[model samples]
Target: MFFIYSFTADTPPNICITGPYKTWRAVIPADTHSLSPVLYCSGCEDHVSVSADQPNSQMETDEPQSFFAAFCQLLFKSVRYICIYIIEFFTGPKQSLKGNHSDNKVNLVLLGMSGTGKSASGNTILGRRQFVSRTSSVPVTTECQVEETEINGTCVCVIDTPDIFDDEIESSVKNQHVTKCKQLLQSGPCVFLLVIQVSRFTDLERDILRKLEKAFGSKAKEQTVILFTRGEDLQCADMNLEDFLQDCNSDLKNIVDQCGRRCVVFENKTSHKHQVTKLMQKVDEMLNKQQNQ
Candidate 1:
């Protein structure tokens, strides 16, 4: 007597089956079945009876076939790896706005009152018009904005934020802006650019450093760089950066001193690259000092 065992795609409904085993049939003679009347499924411990006379007798095979089992196992592994690759291709690695501090990326957050040319300064640093900059009586940037660029092979991320220190703005809204800026930092090293006009310091900006500390915590002043915009006004007065700072009022001078005397002047109207270069140098030096401490 002869007995035939068949396997189908849906026959072995078990999790142990790893591959598509469809229409696989094997023949066994009843005389041979007396020694081993049962055969186990490939990659599965479940056994099937192939008895002619008793039809319910189950036994295990001493040795199974090699080539067919090896093929199924190899196919399953190949399919699994292909799926993993496809998933990784669609959802790539995660990256922050400026990347981590270990990557040597610079994150510059521009903070100041309105009409201080903060957006213009951001455009100048990126060498492009990334943020909207125009003269207006009210604030132009109403939300936190970010732009990134590569400077001398160093990655730089510039975050332009609205005037959160304004009394008219709601505290909730101001908190939202601060929260967004912190999220962008991604726990990396950051330098705040406290933008101030060259010749247009107002009473509103007198206690700006204190406001910055309140918003960004105590370490704000230590990691800050005084960015003075509208350098053309200084040029028209025939005054250089050092001369202007020397003649500045005691209040402004004190603010600059508290920021470790780190400052840079930018003439946004001009296309000069030296001013941006100077600002990046100041930022790099401040970051290095912070790292050392």
Candidate 2:
């Protein structure tokens, strides 16, 4: 036996199924919208009328109509849902001007103590003088600043923050800076570039990870990467970063381990684009790992 179920208005009947048992076919007119083609093998004498509403309601059947009736009900529901999905897809509510996908930016924030090359690293990442970076004995960045550019088709927003947690900076000013940093990153995903001088990790920075966790919750380490500035130090040592870190002190190793061993090196004085590409790749890998979790 065979059966056909036609859905379209002008097209020929669509062959639905074939079986060895005798079958019955219900032909619905194109103009009629009440009941579409519904086929039942044994029970064809009585019409199975289905309302446009309540398509999944129990059908009148003496035999087991679970398969056939459920199929018909599912077909009706699928058509209705597909129509709704299409309508909503085209005429759905508009995204907020601020919440648009183009605004799905990623913030790469430079965070560390004073004189750790945070500002210079920001300039290196942006590939321009977005922040003031000069030979200054004092910290140049006094307030939180941000600059944006596109990288790998993603809007990369780099935020330069002052040495807020430094003892020289006032507590009230640090509080305000922290608030502003949160505001800048509230709209999108953010990763912390814990910038530090290659050979100049101070005791103050030993507790820097603790401070970050206290301020941004314990997950801060998960989103952080140890950015060793002044790659020349490693070059002068005649060693690559991985070898240097392996022989590095326990404190530095602890910091790296806390951040899931995520680390990258940068030479702010150089114009090497490959370094930026590699760093961005590490950032993407970190983000992907977080998402999978």
Candidate 3:
């Protein structure tokens, strides 16, 4: 006599049957071996059976298989990232994935009254005539313009603006010019070049610093550098920058003092590269000091 039964254990139970000319054997299916189902003889009255509450062995193994698959996937991702980093180290990235180098540039904003040589000074700093600069009864730079150049490996952005401090210019127009200048400031430290002609401080320029503060906030003075244009005027007068500043009007001296006494004399008519170099050195020093603070 034989009977079929299914067990959930890993191994089949051993059964012993003793009767007159009767014996029983156990068998397991090949296809359902993982389930560990067992067959027993019907004559075996005493034997262990699987309970309904017991879980199958096949179901238990599924969790391990899932975990192994997840582990393999994680290992593959790790290898891929390593390969990418190695490739980049060897061949370098095709482009800047984060941002461009222009974000690290320093902006040099030219601010002064009309006929103060702002446009000419901008051209001198850039070492090119990017702005229309010429002697005229009216403002030569009627709008704001931007140009870029490199000074001693440092990227420099020069911004030339119209005479926003002019009394004749409408307040709305002045505000618009100021707004445009602020927009072009972009992302970087800004240094304002308060251009003033040598020995030419007029009534219009007396309160120029106050107007600058009104346009760009009071902190503007902290980063301002008084740029005296037409160094030839000082040379013709047989005086150096120090002498000129010493004899300058009280209001002009006060403005320079308010700007931390940062000043540079530029002979825009001459091709003296050292002048630009010296100015850039001062700018670097200012930037370094700002960083330290």
Candidate 4:
């Protein structure tokens, strides 16, 4: 005869079965997060009494020793699979987590439409004019550029990409930009800074996020931070960044939510080192949370 049962760790395994046939009970460890139903069967062997405390005691069976070894192997394989599932549940997305930790550096990729102050934001973060930022009728940065600096005791490498999301741009040209961006990603943990102008959320800006997802896959936003430039707009209205976000349109809110609500504001015109410092703090927080998971 055979019997099967399941119980949580907190429950006392006080099961006692008696019959003319031999009886075997399998008790799962308490530390396991989940309980899988286990079956035990009596075999042609002498009857031996077992107590609840002695869960690991071997049950006499006329079956070959190899049969027991095979059963143990299958049980361990199931436990290992469960462990991997639990780990993936806690760690949300992996796009931002891939990198060699030995080379401690963070890659900050600046991406957005033309005239969105991406270059200026890069300059502000680096505390110097590393990229050409100027008022122009056309996209100032026609290619991807990179620069490095030390921020808050961490090495930061910023990549400035052109307005590759423009529909008018040829697909071949956009492919080239994408290729260059991938080549520039040979640093440590990376995060994309999706820059946009404050108080000027255009229709194109609304759709640019969708395009970003198409180009970088659905997990793109997991490693992305929505950076709103021209912070003076908020200051002039006596509103903080959160306050502004609370009143913004749903499109922007959805974008922020997709990125795990990781957003920051930067007044590129000002030289306030504190602003850069605050943004870096958000970046570090994201890194820490991802690493812990």
Candidate 5:
């Protein structure tokens, strides 16, 4: 007997097998848009019509491999490749007139106070775990660290910095971080990702941006993107991103306006696959607009 399920959906269907777990086949490609699972009992064998709008949930496997299992694996692998290609068209770099991947490379600097998930957003964009996060009462990132990664063959450099505006630091230490930022931007044109917690907005963020204004001039906002971390704060309720931002306090609006009205929300805890794609798409859209102008 076999049961097929998908892990990439919402409203995921879960069927209780009073007995034991069995191998399953996913009728549709596993993805974020998948709906809950629909179990096909071994005896029933009704060909369920999977809806494209329906999303599946993460599936759990408990049995050993079989010939059919191998075949199913190959099928899904092909589907994954296809999906990545199509999604890359939107979320990844754009193709050039010469049919080559476009090259309007930009360095992105992440700025925010401690515990704002700056590094986490960088890891999500780079498609790997490239930075660390801390939940301590005190700040952890002591120096600026730079890492280079690629998405759809476009090279990107992500610089993660310590809390430049941490209260514990003196002017000398603050300038050290400022120097590091210049070095990171040495490669070429760059953008900034201003991260802030979703639950609360603070004046400290604005004060830091004031310093950034001095460094990059008023143009920094044009190159900046506001990334709100810990999106799980809105997970339970049904809310749009704009509504979430509108509900923010005065301090948040000041920061948002400084970033040229560009913003992306992120959940650093769980891997909600599509969020990264959506974020990068917005990032590319901003860059593309700037290039055209």
Candidate 6:
């Protein structure tokens, strides 16, 4: 018999089921903003008893272990349904949560169409202009480029890919770009940052996501986040980020939803390091959330 809990971006959700079978304790942390208020379904016929952890001693029936098993089955089913419900209910088509964390670790894959600030974000993350920057419209990233930098004592492998979604470009060039991204992901866990301008979001952004799905498979969805360039422009001393996102453009909102509502806007043209630190903090939060869940 078992019970399960799931996590989503909306609610500070994470639950751990521990202890002996019938006496197992469900720890719902203070920040867990659960979607449903009810955990113990009162209608189940498994001779089960339930009570709020805070309100009373657990309401336990003198039911057999097998009786608890039936209730456990119901509980497991509820958790499974809720997990998918949260993602589908709120998660957008373009953004998604990063995948499970393991000992494999993760690298960063900076991807997007030309002029979306991929190279700039890479430089901001690595604390240097590791790749060429230009004003021309043509995709300068003729091939895949790989570089590794350390951030906060962690090895940050940054891989830059050419515009794979470029239709006018040569097919060979596109395929080479895709190959580089894959090779990098193969080395370890990868966080693909879809760099884009903060001033605007467009259909081209969604189109790029579809291209990524085709080239890298759905697995990439879990490991991707939208890095909004020119974010420092939007920062406010009084307004919170949640408000900013709520008031953002539909395209921006869509991208935010895609990356599991995770965002880190930055001012790439400036020489501030706080933006990179914020990015690291977001990644670390993601890891810690997965671990606690």
lDDT tens readout by residue for model 4, 233-281 = 8999999989988999899888787788888899988999988877877
Put down candidate 6 lDDT per residue, 1-293, tens digits, no spaces.
34446565565343334325334433222322432222233334323333222332343545544544445434534554444455555553432233344433458888888887888778777788888877786767666777887665567788887777766777777777687667765455567787877666766665666677877887565667778776665764444457678887776676677768767777788878888888876776666565767
Residue 34 Cα positional deviation in candidate 1, in Å, after optimal superposition: 69
- lDDT at 192, model 1: 95
- The local distance difference test score of each candidate is 0.73, 0.73, 0.71, 0.71, 0.64, 0.63
TM-score of 3: 0.65
Candidate 1 Cα misplacement greater than 4 A, ranges = 1-103
In candidate 2, how many Å is residue 109 off? 1.0
Which digits, one per residue and each the tens of the lDDT, describe model 1 over residues 1-293?
12232323323211233234532222222232132223345544544433334333333334463454444334333334333344344444645332222455778999998999999999999999989999898889998988998887777889999998787789999999999988887334688999999989888788988889999999899989999999999999999999999999889999999999999999999879999888878877777666657
- lDDT of model 5 at position 7: 32
Candidate 3 lDDT by residue in tens digits, 169-249: 899999999999999885778999999998688988889988999999988888888899999999998999999999999
Candidate that scores best on TM-score = 2
User: What range of 10 consecutive residues in model 1 has the weakest lDDT sum?
Assistant: 27-36
Error of 6 at 204 (Å): 1.6
Model 1 residue pairs with clashes:
none
- Between candidates 1 and 4, name the one with more favorable lDDT: 1
Candidate 3, residue 261: CA error in Å? 0.8
Error of 1 at 140 (Å): 0.8
Regions more than 4 Å wrong, model 3: 1-104
TM-score of each: 0.65, 0.66, 0.65, 0.64, 0.61, 0.58
Give the 10-residue window scoring lowest on summed lDDT in candidate 2: 26-35
Worst lDDT 10-window in candidate 6: 27-36
In candidate 4, stretches whose alpha carbon ends up further than 4 angstroms from where it belongs are: 1-103
